[model samples]
Target chain A: MTTANAIRLRYALRRERFSLDVEAEIPDRGVTAVFGASGAGKTSLLRCIAGLERAEDAYLELDGTRLDDSASGLRLPAHRRAVAFVFQEPRLFNHLSVEANIRYGRQRRSDRSPAATFDELVEILGIEALLTRAPSGLSGGEAQRVAIARALMSAPRLVLMDEPLSALDAARRQEVLPFLERLHARLPVPLVYVSHQQDEVLRLADTLIALDSGRVFASGPLEALLARADVPGLSGAAAAAVLHGVAGSMDDEFGMTPVESRAGQLWVAGRHPNGTTLRLLVPARDVSVSLAPLSASSIQNSLAADIADVLPCSDDSAVLLKLDASGVVLFAHVTRRAVAQLDLRPGQTVFANVKSAAVRPVFAESPPGPA
Target chain B: MTDLGPLLLSLRLAATTMLILLVIATPLAWWLAETRSRLKPAVQAIVALPIVLPPTVLGFYFLVFLNPNAFAGRLWFEATGSTLTFSFAGLVVASLFYSLPFAVQPLQSAFETIGRKEYEAARTLGASPLDAFMSVVAPLCRHGFLGAAVLSFAHTLGEFGVVLMVGGNIPGETRTVSIAIYDHVESLDYAAAHQLSAILLVAAFAILLGVFALNRRRAAAAS
Candidate 1:
């Protein structure tokens, strides 16, 4: 009830070109991603919160402790603040070997004890083999992994990552994402990740703070905020709603994995062991709605749902129908003509039509939720 | 025979000048690289003055500035009881000024190469400002330090006009290898002049070669 460990930041920075002024509160557990396009002040916000950039009218508090408050003239220097940053570039000390880079923070940490043990961090990040190697020899993925481990070894209360995966190519990104998910599951410290990638947000973020031109566009639980239709230009044309589900069954013959959620069982083209928690992103444009189920349709997924709400699309030429499937929320983008034909209203039962191919598997965690 | 006095004096002066400049230029170059102050350009221009100013002009100003009657000269006289011109201490002051850009330019460029990201990364990892510089900035800029030290030492070794004006070609007191070579040449002692000049030439070439080799290795490793 006390909102202990919650992070609150309000800052205003004025410069010649871009000025960032934003206020946001994030839960101090799980990964809260600051999602935005480039030049959205994502990195600037992280720098300000880390105390690297001083801002006018700045107020930053973690839980109840004031880390920075311009009104009170209390500003904790970056070194004194228990925040670790994983930069976009690995930024490893080229002079130091991997083992030394990871230990650099630990050696200088104000608290002698670390929140995560060194062995555990190395094992989780899969960096044990790279321990003695110098940073110059590391591939992009390997260097980023070491950078993450190094940040964790410091035992910070918070970790701010500025597009840690942005610099890597696709294959390298795939290589590092699982380790990130593992870190997310294992570490209790809150992580604030700044990224322009939607897939990364859908996969990793528990809370999403969407930014637009240095201001908070919207901030809330990833599921609820991303589903809202009025947030124009959010994630571009591929914008979709995210749903959490548990893997129910896998059929080898069909090469499909059945994911059961409050919205009902949906088949996706993937294979995961039963009981693994999965995150699915169903694009709104991919979904179709009808008053009754299509019996002879090639489209695979059809679920009975009640109309939750109606909101205009960004251009107002269409309407986004919010569907409440059991307790889960799904969005369907339909033409005004379709809505007129269906006469969809709140409390009305309708079939939400979805193609199994459209149900993309975003991410999977072995043991879900913060540990 | 080596006649090792002028040679030793030259080595000692170069070594001492390099050491003092390292101490003085590290912070100044770091500040120049990192500060966003309005006066940054003005400060940078002043630091770069010696590179463009003719050695004779700098030497003339230094001669007047270090005269026992002037402010700095009077202070030096009071502190060390010796006139600034034609003394070993005066030679040191002149060398420091002459070789300053050599010491600072490489360091400033190196600090610039390291950039603010690493420093910020270090700070987030709970390193104080000084701690970050010592641990993160210093090691990362080792190449810069190498370049600066080698260049400063070589530049001091080859110095002629500034040392001549300030040190007054005094043997065993203020005379460096360059001055000694010049004295030998003026007196038509071609053997002595060639001996000292050869040493300077070989030493400068070897130092430069070492620097270039190290830089190439670094570049290759980076690639």
Candidate 2:
């Protein structure tokens, strides 16, 4: 990948018990989710990029600007790097009011013009009522929203969020996820979001960097990474595929929406507006393959798919089949007995049956209509 | 009536020492709170030495170091044409040493309580190190600063051995309240000594009460 419009990082950090050595060029637009387990050195990588943690052997260049280069002995301090970070906890200045906390970064920006005005940020985050309140007085979701606003007001070239919603409970995470989706759609700044939660990654990420034990297991577009069975956590029970398509129309009688992708049309259990772009998540376990289309089954969606690759599952009880419906990729987890009974192979053409209820519409571009 | 000149001098010495110590100890305390250097324990022990060492021992060293014959004293003598021992300037210096830990420990603990989280937050928000400390850290540590200042001032007010050792009973200059009370008792003036002793006793209690109240309120707010 070209380094001109990408964030190039090469860091080798060794701690007593954990070490992180990664070199990857991340795209400079959209949300790049660093998906990993708890100790996968995801936070360490973000810290190194932000200049909060110094690695002895490191070279980081963000959009053609040299932030760190161990060879030349040039390392910009954290404040000068202009890489805003939103930690898991709010970490707001307890002494400052919510408005003052948001302005803390704006007032310190070296650039005179801000990317988004204060009013626009407040509206985006829905934090106008929270402007004058103290940080201590706000709820967990509200504080995280304010933290996001604060990071964006700084006019940073890039933003790093280290599991900003992990500290909150399930309800609070739900509360904050929508605002994040909105920000992802509108903000011009690129974001490096670290999260172990697959649901969050599915909701917000366009690119995926899967880290395993302080190493880069895989890095690519989210759809491609999710389709690969070799990548950890994307197989067996956790296996799923994401499909991007435009909403065709809504069936008012059944309250179902038809989304059209290159793979084929799949009816989803929702009322998405016509012409809206949507991302549908199809779990591998939810799909079943047969030699011919089902004539009497209740499953509403069936597409002709060519078996691309059949790989063994980690549990040995089943096989994960990669299927290509037209050009889109999908996965089907079936038992070995069934795979043999149907004699499914790489070159065989089959019909893939999917329950419309199982095809979940994860994201939509247009603002959600009233309930 | 008991002479008030010594009382005024003692207040002046305490206030001057407290103000100067605030300026000097802030950075030292900040370094102690933030650094991960191997020499941190050694530096902490040195800062706390005055707390454990006998006041006279500290006073004796200060006197010797500031005497006209010593290197530091000789430099001062050459620069100002006046010796450092047995003067009000000498007493302020002695009290600063005597109250070093008082000013440092509170500020250090305060800085530690605030921790490096918010400071790093500020840094990432585009504030320089100094700017972060001023805008985020110093405000959060306001109570610590107040505690340090009050403790240093009150501790200096009650200092007797260090003052007597380095600054002799010079009436209008070096004779602080403690020395005045000591002089009264030595000269069989029990009534005069009682007056000075009671004032020191009440002032110490009030200062301590104020500190405890502030701590209680801070703890409540945090919870």
Candidate 3:
């Protein structure tokens, strides 16, 4: 497989208590985060994609090459499929030294483009001191780092990580997460990171597949998917909004990047120069609506947007507003009193006044062009 | 009182049994643990039958039926020797049947506990069946191999009834430590019997205790 626009999976598997029925296409691009709760069949879905489980009529294709297709009875064994998997646990062989495990994957490659250089990955994951130790001797985080390096060393077409960080404590997670981010940003292989944590999802994923009870509840670009508050990990007030805009200018006085959107100019605190596409998260609760545009306010910019739709909230009159600002869904959860006071109605134009402090700026650019 | 021939024979038999069993039991146990094939339980039961069966009954079947004028029996005699009835070879055969469970059970449980996830991980990493087994399964379950080895060695060292039935009481050929102790007691040599029995007990205890200590060490490390 030549690696761009890879995996396609459409399959059904019946278990005792649940049936895994998911249809997904993993872009042969950057990280695709599979977000779900514990026991939501996240691991099983990764397993199926990696060719660990056999399902009937399982039509799976990677870069136009059929891995499994019952139409012609073609099933490529996992070893032949060129998919690297990082399991929840490190699963490192106790007998092999750390270098050996890393070399294990490198040795499996038939054609090597750029091997995840031992020194580079060891430095990247900070596993240099662990080279001589066996897996049984390494700490959990250390073992997992070695595991990731090993998977990368193979130079496989796609890498699948099944909750690779859930076992770590918060501090260890923080330590490893940046290395993981670096790995994805640098690696040539497409990565499929399976995680339930929203922070991990937002920090890493370019595309998202939110799994709920053995089904793909939602799957799309991370910006669009994270905008849906009803998506499990993207819930309540915290994980509601993803805003992508192009940098227009840097305002030294206000310390903000003048980001341009279809909604209008947004004053966001970002370090990028003019004309860099960026993605940032704005939680819905952070966004409050003002009927009239305010000039003498601490809030940065007021953009015009039409209310797209509304859904009932806890109270009878209170509702969740889906605002369309240049095709981006910005959720605003306001009480019924405010809704009536603002004279909010679907298809009615209103000023969306948001604060510069409200937007949590993230360094994001478009998918790297195919090399 | 302490002629070391029987002790040497016991060590030889135990070591040989473990070596042979490791080759046979590993794949058998791995398959038993991994496959959902039908007749699995039935096959496992058959392998485990010698553990539960009366030693005399098992010895009776092996001694009489195994050496019949039948085609298999003639072939066995011709390949090895006509004197298969009372030899160290015969004792080794008897010990293998008697000690099968001690080796197979630990290895089977160990292989079972390694779980499908490790194999799945290895498979996705481009390791084939043989590669996964050597690199992943075998190393990950090292304690099981140790337990199986120690159990098989000690079990073979303690073989008495099956050896007596299948391997006649020949001093150098068939007489293991347990058999030698039995001979001393039967001859009214109480002091010699006690000495030989004490040595055997100490050696067996040391082996078993070492295994349990390793098991505890593994458990402690895990916790």
Candidate 4:
């Protein structure tokens, strides 16, 4: 992307034990997930972008606006940056009611664009009933939703979320993830989401920036990066391919749904309405390779594929194989002994069996309507 | 019958001292709570000196510093044709010093308890530093402000040595309740002393009761 349509960041911070040095240009659209382990400078990077933590040698430009230039001694304060942040905790003002907390930023916003109306955000976050309640009375999920609404109401040019769902329990995370997905699809302002949870990234992010030891190990489109078997954390045990497809029809007798994608047709164990777009997450471990098509197998989904590349896993017992299934990429984890026995190589034809039960449908596109 | 002038003068002095201390202690307490500077301990020590140092010592310093010939006293004398020593204004100044810790300690602790996370959150939400403090910090710490005001007022009302050294015994201008009780006792009038003393004791108890009740309510709400 051109400089006018991207966020360029160059920061170098040195502390007693840990140091951060990163330089990247991220597209100013869609959800860009900053994925890394704990203490990988994820929160530090977000803080620097929000102007909360000033790096001595830093230059940050968002959509061509010079937010910070250490060389010229120009730095905008956090309030003036028009960059809103949602912390892991709700951090709502205890003195104000939920409605007041959400309106606090909207009233003080310097940009009077009226991008998202108060009623619309309240409805979108499902916080209309919580407007009059105090933040202290809300549950973890409810408070977080209010916090998200507060950030959006600020009319920020960019929004930064630092593990917005990390503090919650599993059920609360599930409760808030749908609202986040809705925001991902509907928000005009780009989001830089910091998370170590792979499932959240796979569900919400369009682009991914993986950080290792405070440096950018890889940065690209999410599909392309996750498809690479060579990247350490992106592959191996957490390896999964997110396939975009449209729902074809539901088999009422078998209780399954057929999804059509560029790769091929795959039957998932669910019922989805026809014509709705869906993303299916197929884990590599659930896929097994056979030399020829299995005539009488329990696995319902099978596709003919050419072996693209075989990569060694961290543990030597198994190997991760990259498969190109008609222009769509998929991964399969097969044992080293099986690879040796079958003598699998690139350019060889194989039938990949996928367990329909293991295929999870995530982030379905809502039917077009008032929302 | 005991004269009521000293009691009224004491109330006026305490009210004036509480108001002025709140204005002066707020920013100082906020700085003390938020700053990581090396000078923080030193500033805190100076603010707390009144609680540890004898009131006579502070009064002696005030007397020496605010006499007619001294710099501050000369400026006051030139401007208002009166010295800062042995006046109602002098008593007010002495009471402020006597009650400085009462005003600052509660406020500083309150600010520390609220922490910087909420303040930073407000800033990112497009509030300036001052705006964040007023909208977020002040309202959250309203009880702390009230506690400070009450403590300062009570502490100033009971002050004896500082007023005796700096303000002397000017009945309506500077003689407070404490001095009036002392005067009554020194003149062998036990009845007058007992009446004023009982009034001060009940007033102090009521003010403290109000503060403790407020604190209990806050704690209950928090829990």
Candidate 5:
């Protein structure tokens, strides 16, 4: 119920090849990730919001300000909309030095406020060394960092990033993720990030909108939506429930970090400072249904849980059970045979056993909350 | 030694022609590069016609068009109280038509290479359309501008048929280096023809070399 800023958008575009109709209301603070497979209309939606693309009948509002209304014939062009975009390709001006490219956006502000200074952004993005170099000389990762810095420099009402990390290699992606996390924490501007990467969504998103074939399949808090029993196929092969936890104690002797959450204390493979908030993705396939808590087991995290709902999978050979462990929701993907043997039903108490190594920890800047 | 008047006039004519062509060709080329209208093909064909049509054909049409009896010539006479044909201004008019493709094609191709992505990116970054073109598109297409300017100037410098049909051989007023070299050869001035022809050859070679050098550097930087 903590409502401060929000973005509401309704757009329908008809092209020769395909048409997209999507309506979503997202938090206007933190990172709201648009998650979907390629050609799912994710980029098109972002382009419409940025005013780079248009729709016949559309409406867009940010923080209660009406930016576009087709019914009223009120359309703000892209340059006047004050939305910054980070394209997939770096798209840095080859004729400009890194400093000039970053400065391009900053110089366009009507009011010259030092809210986000060039030096500060360069430092945060770790592009200080590249300030004097040309964009052609920088590696892929360095150019992307500079692109992010340039977008941030604009002091925009909202930032739309269209698969910003998709162009980089795995090694380069790892190098730039921390800077993005820092940006998420420090900047007050709302961000609409488009990505199909589950790990990126888990780490950065405060709200999630899943697009499937030009429509919103699901839209809600990242953790709750991913744990839904009704949306079984939405998660695909890597069906997992995201848990928001704080790093508790670092067990260097074992090289594991104990993450405390509503579900239980789970040990993840990492070393982090105490009280650092992180996201953990517990794969549904990694959890096993147990009639009672065993005294000794290879699984280190076992929590008492009550089955909330059970839905059959697409293949019908498996069942996805939504479990409520204390106050947290966890998903358990178990075979239909196991479900029948265990007699799993709604409101029935059981233990969900998860291995210590099954938890994938995500470094998130801010936990999902209203405004 | 060779009077130098014709060489200087040719340079002046080429410079003036390039300046006017740039002012007109930039937007025309940009429109050709970006528009999806049904008329795009027709406009593009008209712009490129000068490249394939024999220079004399264009010169013949210009001769009729620049006559004081024609509408364009009458408009020129009313505006300046002077005749259009057989004047320095007539040569300029003839040269613009003769060299338009040279100015526009390079620019159009250059504009095409920069593409729409960068312009969209600039818009999202809060640049107006004009600002985006000036800041991003113009700089990115610098080589195109260079090629267009050089080719148009060089093409105008050597203009022979169009100048002859439209401006005639009026010394110090319309006769350019090409006409001057022609006059020398017609009068059996072998030494003068060789010297002027060698000068034109060297200038053309140096201009083409510079353009090629620039293209090589751009390619190297891109890779």
Candidate 6:
């Protein structure tokens, strides 16, 4: 499969004390999650792209269109630019009713694009009953749904979500994230999701741009960048990678998506798009090793990979193995118990059995690694 | 027997004065609440001046200014063929000046108390400044406007020195409720004074009750 058009943003933007220094490129076709700590300037970088904040020496081009280039002093105003931003707080207009607030951004779009129907959005967000209520009356989840609906209505070329779920509690976040997944899979516009949570980015993003102290720490395919043991906070135990696959056949009776990946046939239980790519993450600790592929197992996925490295840390209790499949590096933490049982050794061909449900997509990079 | 002439004249003067003040104060208070002009503090202090000055001081200035011999008085006399003092119009002017601050400060403070972040939210969403002011600021400042109106009306109803100096208590031409009560008291007709005092007390209480009742309605609506 070919990669879609993307944005290339390079240059430095400095202010008196806090400066946003960056060099990065994100695909124009899918979600590019900016993951960082609270003060790592993730939101500032988004704001610069959205034209909400001006930055000197900031060069940003989206799919070949020059949106901001400060070397020659070129920039677009927030409203004039093709980006719509959803702040951490819902920020719905209090004087307006829910319906009116959703329509506020809809009225601002000058170009004709495929807009999410008002009814569709309200239905998807489950906010049909809240149309006439004032913003003051909405609960946090409901208000965020309205915010998301409002932002989507603008038909932006690139939508910026600045910690949209950060203000929500866990249960509420769980409720909204699935809707976000479905929305991203459905919408045509690219998204730049900014978050501090690695789980969220792992579950949602196609491209991950990890920032540290206002600099790009790593930028690439979410799974590939994250799978490497060298990724700051993601090393050893926390290392995880996103995997993309297509639904091969329906097993509705068993409730599984038969995914066709280079890792071999993997079956994950969910309602997945038939042929389109679905992203899922496989954490480092979740995989188990066996010299021979077990056919009688209950686990769904058994992938064939070559052992890339075997780092034997102090404890014979466990070992870190880097398995390479083409250009992808997947990590597995085998306990000393399993290593001895299977007689696992370096350069040995092995079958790594990972539960289909245990796999999830790379959504966000680990927080601004090491401050 | 009740004197219908003075009561009717007083009611009419009070009604017109309050109405004009409401219209004038609404916009002035709105501006005072939002604008950060260099002149705002001075304007606020001046609006509040009427509350502290003796009514006679305020009235005497108006009285002199509106005298036919004075420049303003001569202009009105030549232009409208009306002398300034001892007229219903002159009492209206005096009452308005006296109650101006009562109508402004509460509203200004109310407007100021509303957070600026709310307005900024609307602006980034593509609302013009005027639209944000009308849609965001005005609705939030509703309570202050009501308070100012109630206070100004009640304060104007109790005016004495300004009306006495500028209105001259002409029975049907310039007299007000306060002036009528004063007239009865001065005449030493204890019975009449008591009757007028009872009526004024009831009126003030009723007016305050209505303000409070309306405030409750506004609160419910806001919620």
Q: What's the C-alpha lDDT at position A244 in model 3?
A: 68
Docking class of 1: high
Which prediction has more favorable DockQ, 2 or 5?
A: 2
In terms of lDDT, the poorest run of 10 residues in model 4 chain A is A362-371
Q: By summed lDDT, which 10 consecutive residues of candidate 2 chain A come out lowest?
A: A362-371
Of all native A–B interface contacts, model 6 reproduces a fraction of 0.27
Candidates' C-alpha lDDT: 0.86, 0.89, 0.79, 0.89, 0.86, 0.75
- CAPRI classification of candidate 3: medium
Ranking by TM-score: 4, 2, 5, 1, 3, 6
The candidates' interface RMSDs, in order, read 0.8, 0.5, 1.3, 0.6, 0.7, 2.8
User: lDDT by residue for model 5 over A99-163, one digit each (tens)?
Assistant: 99998877887564534778789888999899999999999999999999988898788999999
Evaluation by lDDT, superior candidate among 3 and 6: 3
Per-candidate total of colliding backbone pairs: 0, 0, 0, 0, 0, 13
Q: Write the per-residue lDDT of candidate 4 for residues A237-327, one digit (tens) a residue.
A: 6687888889887998888999998889999998888887888888899999999888898998898899999888887899888889998
Task: Please give, as one word, the docking class of candidate 2.
Answer: high
lDDT per residue for candidate 6 within A1-371, as digits (tens), equals: 22345678875767665667888777776678887778777777777877666676778887678878877778866656657778898988776798988887667564647347888878877889999998998889888988988888766777889999999999999988977877766677778899888788878887888877788888887776776566555556666666666666677777777777766677777656567566667777888777778799887778887777776534458777778755566778777677777777667888777877787632222222121
User: What C-alpha lDDT, on a 0 to 100 scale, does residue A171 get in candidate 5?
Assistant: 95
Each prediction's RMSD over C-alphas, in Å, is 2.8, 3.1, 3.8, 2.5, 2.2, 6.5
Q: So what's the TM-score on candidate 6?
A: 0.74
In model 4, what lDDT does residue A266 have? Answer: 92
User: lDDT per residue, candidate 3, A1-371, as tens digits?
Assistant: 22456678787787676777888887887889988888767777777778887765488887788888867888788888888999888988666788998888777775765446778888878888999987888878888999998888777888899989988999889878878877766666778999988888887888898888888899987877766657875764444667767887797776778887766777887566878776666666667777778888888878777788766655465577778877777877677788887778899777777777777655545556663
Highest TM-score: give the candidate number.
4
TM-score, every prediction: 0.91, 0.95, 0.86, 0.96, 0.94, 0.74
In the order shown, the candidates' DockQ scores are 0.85, 0.92, 0.67, 0.90, 0.84, 0.25
Model 5 lDDT vs. the true structure?
0.86
For TM-score, candidate 1 versus 4, the one ahead is 4
Clashing pairs in 4: none
Deviation in angstroms for A107 in model 5? 1.1
Error of 5 at A159 (Å): 0.6
